[model samples]
Target: MSEAVLETRDLNKNFGALQVSRNINFRLDAGARHALIGPNGAGKTTFVNLLTGVLSPTDGAVLLNGRDITHMRQDRRVKAGIARTFQINTLFAGLTVLENLYLAVSEHLGRAGAMFRPAGARREVVDEAMAALDGLRLADDAGKTIRELPYGRQRLVEIAIALALKPKVLLLDEPAAGVPSAESHLILDVIEALPEDIAVLIIEHDMDVVFRFAREITVLVQGGILASGPPDEIAANAEVRSVYLGEGTHD
Candidate 1:
């Protein structure tokens, strides 16, 4: 097995009297495709936020490639090779696709900010952005603004932006959410095509997306692990079925 790219060691989080996240131990190996799924209030988002440093844990650590990064800020985490896409598309609606991706590249390089100048004018940045977009089969839409593209394409752009950072770990929070079923496959294909060295951790409600994309599944309920195993084992587990899967048709 590969060394873990991202992990939480006995992590916990709370808001005053409300304890939303429990002591959670999770691991994602290099190149591993894994899913984190549960009921709506399962604290999945909180865990993602904690892992990405959007929210600090009340206790425990977040490790990146065997290094402790539990106290690092979100931007530092990005530079350290952790990137994530939100449940909502966070893009500059007026900016062209190329421009948006360039923002990612430039940010990763710690060069000019997206507002300072046209990143496309920077040879190195544009070159990197173009390469990423091309891989997603979205090169032709490079000139289109974020608002002009369909939801699916925008979702792809989100991944492309994350890719621009050259991250060693990618956390995708509902990459296919809000996309039409017809176009959702584009999101999955893009994810499937990513290089195998970057660990991928996805949180999805769509069983089709989860089962198809993840080799291993971790079921979380109330911020704790309900079960963790291969897809077959998760599918056959009675506890997971009753608590999460719930008789849904699965592939």
Candidate 2:
């Protein structure tokens, strides 16, 4: 296989006596469409935290393009080509969608300090932000405040913000959470259309979405990997079904 864009080796995390991640040995290759799924308390969020440096592991290391980044700061990790969206919408409710995207694009360009200037004065920033929005077919909503958009569109804006950072790896935490079923397909469609060179990892509870978007699936049970393989293999695995899918568990 090609070198992984992101990797975790023997990763472990502990809160006193309770372990949240257990010797995780995982890899995300460039352009990988991977899903991490399991029941509640399976430590999916904690594992993402470890990768993004929101939480440090008790042992092991996180690597990006073969460089050790376990000790990297969270913001530093983002600057180093890893970007993520939370399970909850994190957009600035009062800001226009374009404005929110402008913040991210400018920050990525190291020009956030100058963003207070009129957008006309920062043409490049505005152009890039609009391009990001346009790529996601959200240009029409650019003038609307985040709160003015529907929840599903709000989630799409969150993704646009992440993409504005030009990340090599994008980690999406429950991108479709709270979206109406009728609109949830929009989320999957957008994900499926993401740039092929950007590795994507999604932590989701919807089985239909998982099966549709993931080329590979990893089942995390009680903070450790119970299974990792192609979607068909994972779908057919008895343990994964019994512990997660069959039980209709949500995380």
Candidate 3:
């Protein structure tokens, strides 16, 4: 079994009297394909923000490979091998795919601001960017602007840019949102094809995508864990069925 590379221990979060996340403990092992799902006001977004260091928890610790990082800064978390994508596409619409990827790769390599880098380093950065695009099956459109691509492909490019960060853990937030059914296959393919060394967590409301992508699922309701287990078990869970699966979740 793989070791738990990312974890939260008895975590809690509050906005004044609103307790959004409470006493939450979660773990993600190497190459773990985990999903977090719930209804509209379930605090799912709050919990994820805490995990990514975008928001501080009221209590408990965030750990990476057993090291405590409860107070780590956002950029530091990224450098520590945690990366995430949002529900919406955040790519530079005017930039070509290659340019976009090159920026991320260069930033990861610490050559983003180098006005005079050796030719060898530049070549390496270019190669890394190309590899990331190729991995996403997006090499053919490397020269195309983000505006020229479909929403789904743009989403994949965002993920590819995250991959360029060479993260050990990846968190994807609603990757298939706004994507047409026809184009969703592309996103699903790239997500499933991600490297096995990276632990991945997905936050999505699309039942079809979530049920198909996650081996294990975590159900959240009113700031607490309702159920967590394998896909079949989650599907069979009584509370999940009555509260979320029946109405809120969708294909």
lDDT of each: 0.89, 0.93, 0.90
Per-residue lDDT tens digits for candidate 1, residues 1-251, read: 66788889999899997888888999999898999999888999899999889999999999998899999988999899989999999998899998898878888887765576654567888888899899888899999999999999999999989988898999999999999999988888888888888889999999888888999899998888899989999999999898777744443
TM-score, prediction 2: 0.95
Error of 1 at 237 (Å): 1.4
In the range 168-221, model 3's lDDT, one tens digit per residue, is: 999998888899999988889888888888999999988888988898899999
lDDT of 3 at 161: 92
Candidate RMSDs in order: 2.3, 1.9, 2.1
Q: Which candidate is the best by lDDT?
A: 2
Q: How many Å off is the CA of 227 in candidate 1?
A: 1.0
What 10-residue stretch in candidate 3 is worst by lDDT?
A: 113-122
> How does residue 74 of candidate 2 score in lDDT?
92
- The alpha-carbon lDDT assigned to residue 5 of candidate 2 equals 93
Q: Estimate each model's TM-score.
A: 0.94, 0.95, 0.92
